[model samples]
Target chain A: MHEMALMGDILDIIMKDAESKGIKQFSRIDLIVGELSNAMPDALTMAFEIYKEQNAQLFTKDASLHIQFEEAISECIFCKTVYKPDFKISICPSCHMPSGKLISGETFQVLSYEGE
Target chain B: MEVKLNTNVLTNNNVAADYNRDLFHKTKTLVINVMSSPGAGKTTLLEETIKKLSKQYRIGVIEGDLATEKDADRIRQLGAKAVQINTHGGCHLDARMVVATLPEFDFEEIDILFIENVGNLVCPSGYDLGQNHKVAVLSVPEGNDKIPKYPQMFMRTELVLLNKVDLLPYLDFDVETAKEDLKGINPESTLLPLSAKTQEGMDSWYSWIDEAYQACLKQ
Candidate 1:
């Protein structure tokens, strides 16, 4: 899965930043994953475990991944109806038009990390 | 200590994609990233597209596969410059992978570059390869539920090429329903039904490319 690649990129960013800050070991990784981000949190967690196993020296034995899940929400451009969207392009319940603009739920970012 | 990063996980890929986009813009190349599920007739569509447009414009292709140069060879047989990128085991092609193959082509001579992404609808749509347009090919045999089933791919793509319409006579695939589903998933996306094998409704695809090329030149 591409989540592996995404996780690799995340680690690369953290490793670079951590090395510069003189942080030798990681205790946890915090991430924000959205429902519409096209990345699965389960897959990301699995990837983190694999990477932690491979680079044992850089991570604590119980290093964990913390994912803040974001729900998908869309607002109708025509009717101004706010509702949870099943997909990116959703039909407005009030106007019955596919004019709902996504307000959130496409984020996939690393928020912070715990290390020393 | 908790370090505040607040960085996008795909920052590296996005950066590389932006760089590739700049290069394509500078060279005035209309790059199209074509994606679909395995065996959705992407190669066939490209082959026919190249054959029809080669007379008017110089075309180049970057073929992505887990392991093979067969698709690239097919394009090469048509007299167009093609470079194949074998991902080994990767499901999709990233912007960096595309940047690595940029040196193989002389962009000055290439008017349009079609990137036939690794045949997976899910992963390829997530990665931007600095293309002017993202097109998803959904064959008739794939069923009508694909649009709803794989909303991520359909949502991000601007165009859906409904290929293999020649087999529509025997199959239960409804074109109108597919259109409605796509509209529900992506209101702005247009679905073009064409049979790459029989050369039916291909003119519209060629015209779309023509319009896209003109639009690229304007920018």
Candidate 2:
């Protein structure tokens, strides 16, 4: 859905960051997409592929997008138990209380990019 | 050479959100970000909420839509200053877009700024528009499964306005089950059943807004 907007921003960031570093082309780009960020990796990769094919000046010939998905984590308020949610179910197994606080999982960041 | 740039992809949007938050704090304006699925009676709820609260508070609206300015137009017809941010096929409204529209409103005269986010449950929940409260409108027609199906929306929001409740009798919808489902996902969140069309259960919504406005004044 909104993966296109995210991919657009990712491409912009990469191009600007790479340009400042005097890197003409990137051999690889590494991204860490949090499970709770609501972005689809397949859609992001598809957008990257399309952008790479169209915008030749922005990347090298064999540049690849490496994505690592981080599991969404939440914590129980009552028992203070931290757990990874199964299919976005935020609940404490021990106390059967909802994990009202989300510790992490809405992270959309570029970890690093390899370039010449 | 591999560069070590552990940068947030949404850094720009986050920065914009921070800026908007600061402005709201300075103005002491209570901002509410309203989100829901398409055709979930979000606009209708807002229109009703405005009709009830406008006499007591100076209200301004920021309508986010993909194509037209219809929602903003509706708010303007109610005699409130409204600015529309058309994403032009974009799925959601970011903080940057909200910041760009700030100049359109005279913040000093406005008491409440209600941002009706684009009618999508998933993408809009992820973006923070620097609002004091995030309210999700889940109409009864959307079914009982939406609370569990779209947990993120209910999880992020502090209040869930169960709109279109007048149709509850005709439709096979259970208010109690919806409340239970929301509790499983977001225990801190409160579910308020109301119908904008029939003005049923709208007083609770008005009271919530009044309390939010009072809280904003304290800050």
For candidate 2, lDDT tens digit of each residue in B169-196? 8999999989888887777899999999
Tell me how far the alpha carbon of residue A92 in candidate 1 is from the true structure, in angstroms, after superposition.
0.6
RMSD of 2: 1.7
Error of 1 at B61 (Å): 0.4
**Share of native interface contacts recovered by each model:** 0.83, 0.75
Q: By DockQ thresholds, what CAPRI class is model 1?
A: medium
Task: List TM-score per model, in order.
Answer: 0.98, 0.95
C-alpha positional error of residue A86 in candidate 1 after TM-score superposition, expressed in Å? 2.6
Q: Per-residue CA lDDT of candidate 1, range B61-176, in tens?
A: 99999998899999999999999999999999999999999999899899999999999978888888889999999999999988998888998999999999999999999999
Question: Whole-model Cα lDDT per candidate?
Answer: 0.93, 0.88
Q: By TM-score, who's the top model here?
A: 1
Docking band of candidate 2: medium
The stretch of ten residues in a row with the least summed lDDT in candidate 1 chain A is: A85-94
Q: Model 2 segments beyond 4 Å from truth?
A: A77-82, A99-101
Candidate 2 at A99: error in angstroms? 4.2
